[model samples]
Target chain A: MHFNMKLGLTLFAIYLLFYCGFVFINTFSPQTMEQTPIEGVNVAILYGFALIVSAFALALIYGVFCRPEEEVNSTSDPVATTKGDV
Target chain B: MIYDVSPTAIVVFLLFVGFTLGLSFWLGRKAKSSEGYFAAHGQIPWFVNGVAFAGDYLSAASFLGICGMIAFYGYDGFLYSVGFLAGWIVALFVVAEPMKKLGKYTFADALDAKFNSKGIKLAAGISTLAVSIFYLIPQMVGAGVLIQPLLGFPHWVGVLMVGAVVITIVVTAGMVSTTYVQFLKGGLLVVFSAILTILILNRGLETKSNFKELGPVAWDALETAFADKEIEILPNDGIWKDKLDSDQRDYVVSRNPNDPPGKITVWKQVKDANNLVRLLECQLLETRAGKRYINGLPEGTGEGQAQLEPVGSLSKLPDDKTETGPLGAFGFIKTIQNSEVKLWRDDKKFPSLKNGDKATVYYPKLVPGSQVLRPGEHPKFAGIRRDGIFDKLNFLSLMLALFCGTASLPHILIRYYTVKDAASARKSTIVGIASIGFFYVLTLFLGLGAMTSGAMDVSSSNMAAPLLAKSISPLLFAIISAIAFTTVLGTVSGLILASSGAVTHDLAVSFLGLELDDQAQVRLAKIASVVVGVIAIALGILFKGLNVGYLVGWAFSVAASANLPALVMLLFWKKTTKQGIIAAVIVGMVSSLAWILLSQDTFKSVYGIADAQGVVPFSQPGIVTIPLGFLTLVVVSLMTGKSKS
Candidate 1:
């Protein structure tokens, strides 16, 4: 229900959707994956590398938006709440 | 073909082992209490823990296995890299913070935080030990593989050595030593891999056409010999000399025979007018009396018997030149994309008399750069090219397990406890993702480089990265191998720690309600480490010669099936009862383990039975067992919901 959790889950969904599509297309249409999507690069290599890069990009985005607010945080307490939930 | 033990390798390996042991001893003094021994007293810096995270996760599978697969099978091997990195996303978003909040020492601590039930402790503890032990096998097996070429030791010796060293590391300092070892090795692995990739690009591609000058008689004779009776083939220049009993010949003969042979085989190398050796060739010398003959094409099993001289060349260049000299990273991929690569394909097998009992010959197949860069080249992924429904499901199942498995691995999960807090855990996961992602990208180039480096050993694909480094320089080879050996040590230490924590913290203290002092607990964990280390050594020696990455896959499947469903449901679904978690963990672990044991791959590979005799229809169990776990949890929770309330 929190904004950060929503953002995290949505981004994860988007990434998984693209990743699963790439995998399915490669499985069903093997010839299509073999075709060069860009000059000197086929669909499989292009999409596979893209998935790896996208993970870091998404992680950076999550880290930026999900920063813990200092006012609600306590440094002394070992189990301080971050943004929401417990 | 014989891998002679190099003095440089011995010195570097000794230095690495000495440094690791010395660090363990130094860290041991600080790890006196239970918290310090098990969780580093929650004192590790986020960055160091992050790098240590990479160290613990990379294992031998990512280094030796992925590179070897890519070297042999082209782009298909990089698929594992993609799957492995994607799993980190799951860890970063879903598991990192909650695990740090809930668990104290082991993965089971997190799972049983809400409900302090004996059943939860028993089930989750067993699952942790199972997954950790399964993960340990590949790391130990990889250690043996590395030792064979680096130390010229037998595989069992390598397994035993790794077991003793890892036990010493774990028992001495526990998490403190494990964290620092992982951090050190993790940094070295990334740096050296980058250097190796740079060297690969700088060397570019050159035609090593040593086999091209073989006279037409040799070719025709080989073909005729394959089609008809075994016959002697000679060079037209009449400069042939018997190279039998040589190291090259001896290496080829050392492999185990697939079947008995009825003939004697002789091999000779052709020399030029100047006495320079040009080509090595095999010939059937004679047949044994009253023996049945099985004849076809020469098998590729024998070393140097049926191999074409390492023959990789650039069929096309970006600038249409003979070679692209010292290209940039993008330029390297682009040139490889445009160029034709002579990838080796093992074609047929035939009985041999002179070489090993069978000779399996690999022919050089010139693949267009586009095809080589694409997936579906590996036999495990051949179903991707086919339109069969089962094949498609199998691929999807494997991907699902990999994506979910990262957060579920017991060894990876317990690292969160070593950090200070949830925020540190999250930050460390991010750092881990970045480092691991960068290393994986380099694997693409490293693998493709080895494929064309012409340094590939036709027999052991596991030696691809080290052999590629060897082709660049012997010193680099020694350093890379020593780093690889430490890579095994770091990962194996982490797994042993996780297994020991499960035994001492979750099972003994939580489940059995054992009251103990910190010293007593640390002592129990050390004993557990030794027991688990011995088990790992035995399994590693038993399962010799398997691809470490593939073995890691089975571990991933089991972890995803057994751990993920229970953890996810318990966190998100409030109605989840202790009974539900216990039932789910036990069912998931047992069913997946049984399914794997009954699968076709296991039947053929592990049991030495016909694959078709397997009870399970498919090899991977995640597609079936993962959902079964969640369903069992939901059903059991609902049935027990009223009683708990």
Candidate 2:
């Protein structure tokens, strides 16, 4: 497996957990979301901003860590392997 | 509110249109071949393509609709921003790089790359067209909505203008010009939005809803004026009209039982003993005779005519502070959380009218800052706040759709082909996520600012961002609006380009086995672009006044259901067959579309059939239809003897 695809999957999973936490809080523990731990900003606003910022952060991590285009293309599967079995 | 047409807006708007057209014409020479027309010959700079991604993705719905929603209903609109930006994770980590490696032009190309089957081409091509057309409607409607105030033109005129301009953009240079236009618009939108956010934070919070330059007058002074005998609460009678003088003290004008038919009761502004002011609500009425009236006067700001006054303001601040000095980002949010905002409630149906006259009233509703900051306040998501399982499911389905939908959208997917390779595509997507995410974060402030701007047009939530700009300065409003119009133009051109590619490349050439040359393919695509552009214009004009965000939500659902399952399975599942992809695409597309059409929302809004129950349990189909798509593909693949590749 290519290192880039593996790293991409890992970052994607981490972000998915963060995103799910957001949805779960909004859905179930909505009262917790209303709590303003950060002065005027509630958990909901803070969480929303965190999710957005984290997406870019994850993408930057992937961009920085992934192999260059030439190296990946040379060793990458012809079909460009993803998570599921082929 | 009266959207007074400004010469500044006109000049700025015309300059934007002219510059867009000029850019398209100048770049027209480069895209003479099919590769250039379809994918900019995979030569767009990664950075440019990334910003263009923002330009293409942040449609009128994201800018106008979401901000309007937030302004009116609070944090629910920002929830949409979170959902929308979250979709980029799927686009970047899963779809972008692989999509660059496999596809040549449209989304269909990637899906059909492994299987040279006509079924794949036909099914994927149809899905592309369906999603593109559905997405195009909101952009078109948003175009008209923006134009009405910016250029003083009617709705249809705005739709026509956007259609014509976008058609020229697509037909002239295709993806090359579209890419640059998107990049320019994307960059301006982000920069200006940041500047707007800064201005909002600097203006800080004020208790009084400042309309025009009217500062809060002392209650003691107002009490002295109201102490006159001219102050009287009159029952519905002709006597109320005689006392309706500006010099007189505040009085209540009750509805007259003997009032003429077709005349709706008006809400009059009156002062209470406490001197707490309740603003007069504006009503817009359209009579059967095609005449329009605003607040019982002809719809104009001329003598004897009435226009809606700008609304929305903070009724109370923390510590009863009349105003807070310039705030930081956290300070702004904190201030709003502790203050009370006066948002408007739109009442469309009034029973007083006897004739066939339609009336929409905009009245104020004061809500606590905490409730406004919380989710589930918007009517669309109000279900989630309730114990109803179906409503919760509806919200969940929409969130899921937004997460998956970005990767599947034909227009967005086609952008990968504009970049050179997997690495560039990855980088471009990263750039896209950064800009789009930053813009979305700014949306919260934009919405909250507009919520407290006290210059809102209660009639249309779509005008929040532009109207917020207007509250700042006319020049800023003009520039922001011009940028917004270009936002619509960039998105519509991308959709049109995607549609044309599907038609000429997939449906015409691949599905029908037409051996067309590169030049011929480009020509056919141009012709297809014109045809799709025309259809989009008509749909845009037709769907005017529908909430731009709702239509976009439906588009996302359809895209996620139809394309995502098929694309994902084909990418990862070696057992996936061409027949499986074909079946999945068709079923997913049809089912989602059917679910939307039959949903209770459609029953009320689209069909106008009150009291009619939808067949589906919920409005959004993503939760059901997306999994259904995957299941259908897997089952069909097993039955059809898989591993075609």
Candidate 3:
């Protein structure tokens, strides 16, 4: 698979967004709000959104950093030649 | 409830269902290839697939359940819509691209892509089926609810019909037909709803006065009939009034008792000369010219914000359920629920309405069935306030499901596979979110419109929005109602597709060590679809009268608990072994299942058990099961890693 720096940048930005969410959750209190919402929507919604965003970021991060780095040397496809019927 | 369904409703409903299945069957004949059965050969255009996501995702719960809730509870129902749409951000940013890149056939394929372990396939497959079955029950039940009213048929017939149709669609063209069905229904739903919204803006809101005197004509008729007789009455209590007389012009309108005609209810008062006391009754009547219908009912008030001026899509919003004002995503809802806002209840009911300063509301009387189903007289977590920690835990758990389940749904994951590339998948998700977001905004209008329209059936809250439309024009009601029917059609079809994939691809081919070729796999899938469809039908009936969307809440919690942790671990935790995968899936699935069955909701709702027998305090298992699933996965992975290479 080709590596795309654009994807990496997008993921990093989302990580920052999640960071903001975590920070905001600590900073603000539901009691500070005009109405105390039930076990419903809160700033934590953004947190929920952020958690998934970071999950994607972390997933992309793993793909980028954890995979065994290989040379861009093999243009040939092993599965194509073997034809093991996947 | 079926009485509310008009003749136009049945014809429109049947035509739409017929068209859907016909397309599926025609597509089925050409689906001889394996590619046709799975991912529709991954050739669906991204734009159509994008809308198809709406069709697949917006289940009966979205259309009927939320709309009904909003009609009854004001803005609370729209909260569900916003939450459902917000979850799409997770799908767009995190799931869409990666999910497409990794998986083929089933969600199990995505989770097991890196490892290719038989254990992952088996466990993932089981979880997929569990979630799919859980999700399927609500859709089937929604079908029954719609059908019971629309066709004058019982709820089970509707469930049975939907199950049969969906199974045929899945058995025939598999995802090929399912994709197109969702695409069609999704497109139809958004378009019809938009048209209805435009009509709403044009019609505007008209205030119906709650105070009017219909006593003279009623008394005249009474005096002519019983002039010489004296009737016994409660002294200084309730006044004796003549029985209601029908408005000659629209007597037909008052028959069904389903569609209450347009009535401007003005308060009526009677003075008893004998006692020197005055009695007031909240009597509303349909006026022919300037006269009132005494015995006959009033017309169903028109739906839409009759009094409010149109605030364009992005203007200073009314205190609506949608993104009204500047509170951001949930700013409006948070302000209303937690803050002190103008909440009105009728004096007759709350007796609190006797306070002359408060705004008086004429809530429709609570009927027998309604009393049973209404969300327990207080919040599901009232126990929390009253030192009931168990109930609080239950409420916390349900929220957990809503929080986690959005990203883990199998039908949702499979949509990514149908798209060609990661970029396309991401783009499609963005488009889907925009569409879903726009529609959720409409739901607020649709719901709140029904509330003040005085067109709501307090009995079946789910029917409020549709009955609101029927108040406007039958033609518009017909088309929109058909679209609502197709909403069930699309989601159920998608679910059946997911279940079929789990059984055929993951369980039979991948896990069972079967060497069958593609044709046999497709055949087995088709057969499995029938069985799954039948099961969905049975579940739908058994769980009827429930808020379909709320019922799906359980499914969401279970999916998040059982699948999300396992999927997350497989990718990030390198030490995760096959045994760990199996154990985690088993523990997560069984624990959540066990907890849900023992939960108060199941005991009270499903088994018809009284409150005393309710084992677990709260109904929702999310708060407990979700964390448990994650912990089990982590701990098992750590323990098992010591020996495995």
Best by lDDT: 2
Candidate 3's C-alpha runs over 4 A off are A1-86, B1-5, B209-378, B381-396
lDDT at A82 for candidate 3?
39
Determine the C-alpha RMSD for candidate 3 after optimal superposition of all C-alphas.
Answer: 10.7
lDDT of 3 at B150: 68
TM-score of chain B of 1: 0.86
Residue pairs with clashing backbones, model 2: A40-B334, B312-B454
Clashes of 1: 11
lDDT of 2 by residue, A6-47 (tens): 888889899999999988778766788888887768998999
Off by over 4 Å in 2: A69-86, B210-231, B236-288, B353-356, B642-645
Q: Model 2's CAPRI class?
A: acceptable
Q: For candidate 2 chain B, which ten residues in a row score worst on lDDT?
A: B211-220
Error of 3 at B15 (Å): 2.4
For B427-543, candidate 3 gives per-residue lDDT tens digits of 567557656766777776576455544455434666655666766777666776677778888998888888888998899889998988878988888888898888888888887
Off by over 4 Å in 1: A70-86, B212-321, B354-359, B610-613
Q: Evaluate candidate 3 and give its CAPRI docking class based on DockQ.
A: incorrect
Which of 2 and 3 is ahead in TM-score?
Answer: 2
DockQ leaderboard ranking: 1, 2, 3
TM-score per candidate, chains pooled: 0.86, 0.91, 0.72
lDDT of 2 by residue, B1-645 (tens): 548889999998899889989998998877787888888887899999999999999999999989999999999999999999999999988888778877878888789878888889999999999999999999999999999988889999999999999999999999999999999999999999999999999999898753312112343343333324232223433533444444243333333334433233344354546655443434445443576676465666656565667888998899999999899999899888988887788666532232556756566666889999998898888887788889888988999999999999999999998876788888899999999999999999999999888788877889999999999999999999999999999999999999999999999999899999978998999999999999999999898868888799999999999999999898778899999999999999999999999999999888888788898999999999999999999999999874565
lDDT of 1 by residue, B366-481 (tens): 57776777878788888887777777777878888888899899999989988777778878888999999999999999998988887777557788889889888988999999
